[model samples]
Target: MKEELIAYIKSELIGDDTMEMNSEDDLLTSGLIDSLAIMRFIGHIEATHEIKVAPQDMVIENFINVDAIADYIQRTKNS
Candidate 1:
């Protein structure tokens, strides 16, 4: 699920910018995406993962990196 999610985010929302990203790529700080783009990703994750993303959960720590987003989704699923 993590791999698939990252692939979607990379191919769709991120595109060719992946040339510079590690698993810990900071999308927000690196300016890869703005707030609107972040929201779009949040929506995508919600729909893809079948999890509800709360407004309070939309933070840099959760969404800045692919690993972080994957962790967030996994944790949410367990919770």
Candidate 2:
């Protein structure tokens, strides 16, 4: 999931195939992605993972990075 998220962010969102990103990278704070990109990313996550991300779940902590997003998905699935 982390790899897929990173790949999607790079190849699809950022449109930079060569961009390097890690699971722990601060995507939001580092300016790697903006609000619009995050919305698109949430759409990607919902369509790909078959989960609904509630409005309240769209917080910074849940989307700080790839790992955080992965964790949020896992928790949502478990619940």
Candidate 3:
């Protein structure tokens, strides 16, 4: 799932070499995900994972990196 999230972020969002980033890399601070792109990426995550990401869940800590995003999705799905 982490790999899939990374692939989606790379191919659909950033479309750059950031796809090769480590799991712990800071995507937002590293300029990989800008302000506007974050919304689109959330939509992508919701659609792909078939889970709702509520407005209250839009915290930077949950989306700091691919591993975090993947874990967020897994937890949300389990809930």
Tens-place lDDT digits, model 3, residues 11-79: 878887453767888988888778899999888888888999999988988988888888899899999
Q: In model 2, what are the clashing residue pairs, if there are any?
A: none
Ranking by TM-score: 2, 3, 1
Regions of model 3 farther than 4 Å from truth:
17-19
Choose 1 or 2, whichever is better by lDDT: 2
Error of 3 at 53 (Å): 0.3
Instruction: Report every candidate's CA lDDT.
Output: 0.78, 0.91, 0.84
Provide the TM-score for each candidate, comma-separated.
0.82, 0.96, 0.89
Cα RMSD for candidate 3?
Answer: 1.5
Colliding pairs, model 3? none
> Model 3 Cα displacement at 66 (Å)?
0.9
lDDT winner between candidates 2 and 3: 2
- Could you give me the TM-score of model 2 versus the true structure? 0.96
Expressed as tens digits, the lDDT of each residue in 2-66 for candidate 1 is 66766776777768636545667777787777677677878888897899998899777888788
Pairwise TM-score winner, candidates 1 and 2: 2
Best by lDDT: 2
